[model samples]
Target chain A: MKAPDFSYFEAQNIEDAIKYKSEDDEAVILAGGQSLLPALNMRLSSPSCLIDISKINNLNEIKIEGDFINIGALATHSDVMNNDLVHEKLPCLVDILKMVAHAAIRNKGTHGGSIAYGDPAAELPAFAVAMNAEIVLSGLSGQRIVNAKDFYLGLFETDLKSDEILIAIRYPLLDVNQHLIFDEVCRRHGDYAMAGLMAKVELDQSKINNLDLVYFATGDKPNVGQNTAKLVIDDGYDYEKLKKSLASEIDFAGDLNSSSEMKLHLATILINKILNKLER
Target chain B: MSAKNSVNISFSVNGENFDDVTVPTRQHLADYLRSQGLTGTHLGCEQGACGACTIEMDGVAVRSCLVLASQANGSSITTVEGFDDEVMQKVKNNFLKHNAFQCGFCSPGMLMTTKEIISSKKKLSRDEIRSEISGNYCRCTGYQSIVDAIEETINEIN
Candidate 1:
């Protein structure tokens, strides 16, 4: 399939990319092209001009800047795994990161690109939301930061303006006492998760302290399940009690892969998987 | 807009520089590379779901069919054909040892995927290795052998 006719300009840096994008009304930033490329080829989106931003430096680094781990927008999945900060500080991020499609696609796909692509089934965004991470977006006039909760409006939609390019995503570090357990059910090993959950829990003796749950691929948008998290904390020690809540109260939805009932069932199964592991 | 049809773009395909290729803005990197006689990169799903068109551009592996030819200007590319790296040979041996290829359409992309993994030297567990190769789909249902191949290759390299 051929994309619609357009002009391409290789931006020397992010400034040039932003400048060119600001100057034109119909231009889109090209990163890994994992999602955008397929969309353009499938005739889903046809921009008048393309701005390639591969040459931008430092946009691919995962740095520990004080209390937050700053993941650059251009940072590839391979880069994330290689970075010492991410591996040490937020290696829980690795569990979810490792679940992305394949090595080839991850090497080309970027952190900002996946968050920008806003695939509800994507593990990263769910992680971002679970961690209450914030996105840094830069447009012609200035830059704005939006929490992951607000960044996602709908399926494949973000608050980003076409003129703006996402710069990075930052999240506060979880405490040493916190244990994270992530579980996703994919048709196969590497495909998009049919249903996934990233849960952060802290146990005080035998009682659950905080049972925060975030699930993806269950609906058109990620359900933070703040209520479910609270309920899990209150009744979490008994896995069966929380398991029933996950199945009944979570209210999961589905897309092309499964049904609403199936999504909900898978979500509960995945949540149980996490709870069981951490319980060990 | 028809007047702005042709744009000169440059990309390094199979580790060689071809700075004079002028392609339509709509042309895909997969098409451009194949047109340049680098037919090693196979095409399977035509969508991002399959890794058949996997290639490294500017050190990052991407779906060639999804990338516009113009997007790859000044980028370095690596493909399966004409690959002679030791790790690549080891990956081939892994496939041979495990007999991973049935249809073989997915093998080229798998090799490319494995190439990216070995180059980084990132610590990979069995679970990570399995997830990393998930982008490529094999219809022959030979994933066990495929994973075995990658594991063997990884072990040989160490």
Candidate 2:
């Protein structure tokens, strides 16, 4: 139940951290150690060195820059959940944050680490994709910004280079006429979602102008329900009939938590439940 | 500076400062605490799921097993044995009054998480309390007694 022997380096800054990564190909960055420590304890991953970046200055800040809210990589789920900026600017994220694992896990699990880990069942990555956020990656070469929809490639796979570190994520602010909903069904409250949805809708005079739905934990990546969104919006947000047509529209794959067929069935029920509340 | 396998760490536990103690970098805070004879912090599902190793680090409750001792080098940790406050005393008394445990393995971490909720000064509903302590799992007692105890404690304090 102990992590394997590995050298530790407490990085002084982003440059210093990238320098270490550049020097060692098998080094892993330690953000909040929520996921990495568990992997290390289970011996699932045996990196030669662990780079502790918790001490890096200016990496855990949440700031509102222009029309976007920028969250640093080291910002914990608790930080994002409790931040007034997040509540006022992106309440959809707050809704998802509240449902993220328990308080203790939220206290230690970081936003960047969660995004970097890229678990398809996780909330932050799904939220990022639904918001069309931007992921900022920093390396010795400099910084590059990738759209959230393109950041994640597959299960536990991301576009982040080995030598690059996720510095921050910028989410575009929701317009005054835009409304969002994030909901999931798990066996237990703190457990991973069996299937979830993060929906963003732009409404003009109670009529839907645009709608986007990102389904999580039902596929290899956070899948955008493009056909369902188009159909539902075209049907005037009438989820009653629209949901019945969604089983064939969205693609789902089975996992231990749920079966593919069940997830397809549950997605309709869950989306309808959320839309019902919105209508009420 | 050359990286050393073992580094000297200094931290405060229960209001006492122990400085410059050499420890392996990979040692978890829970294991380190137990090694120092503070066995109240129990370990269950060391992967941070069970939450038996929860402790207060700089006033935030965190799973100690997931946190490296080296990460807690400068942190002030308060374990279950060192919890001495009026609110915690009330909580402890409520646990006894409510018979909150059959097996004491999860008590220490449960109490730590409970303390955090009380200190936060929120008016959490019954379901909210359950959600708040969902991280701490108790195999025995079916958790109703624990919830009753917490609610009773909050009601008394208010």
- TM-score of chain A considered alone, across all candidate predictions: 0.90, 0.92
In the range B35-149, model 1's lDDT, one tens digit per residue, is 8777778887666888888887667677888777776777787888746777777788778888998888787788888887777777677777777777877889788998888
True contacts kept of each: 0.70, 0.78
All DockQ scores:
0.51, 0.77
Candidate 2 lDDT at B101 equals 66
Model 1 pairs in collision:
none
lDDT of 2 at A54: 93
* TM-scores for every predicted model: 0.86, 0.94
- Span of ten consecutive residues with least summed lDDT in model 1 chain A: A234-243
Runs in model 2 deviating more than 4 A are A236-251, B1-4
All candidates' chain B TM-scores are: 0.91, 0.96
Residue-level lDDT tens digits of model 1 in A137-240:
99888899999989998878788886789999998888877777898888876688888898877778756788778889987667777766886666554456
* Global lDDT scores for all candidate models: 0.79, 0.87
lDDT for B77 (candidate 2): 92
Candidate number with greatest TM-score: 2
Judging by lDDT against the true structure, name the best candidate: 2
Reference-based lDDT, residue B20, model 1: 70
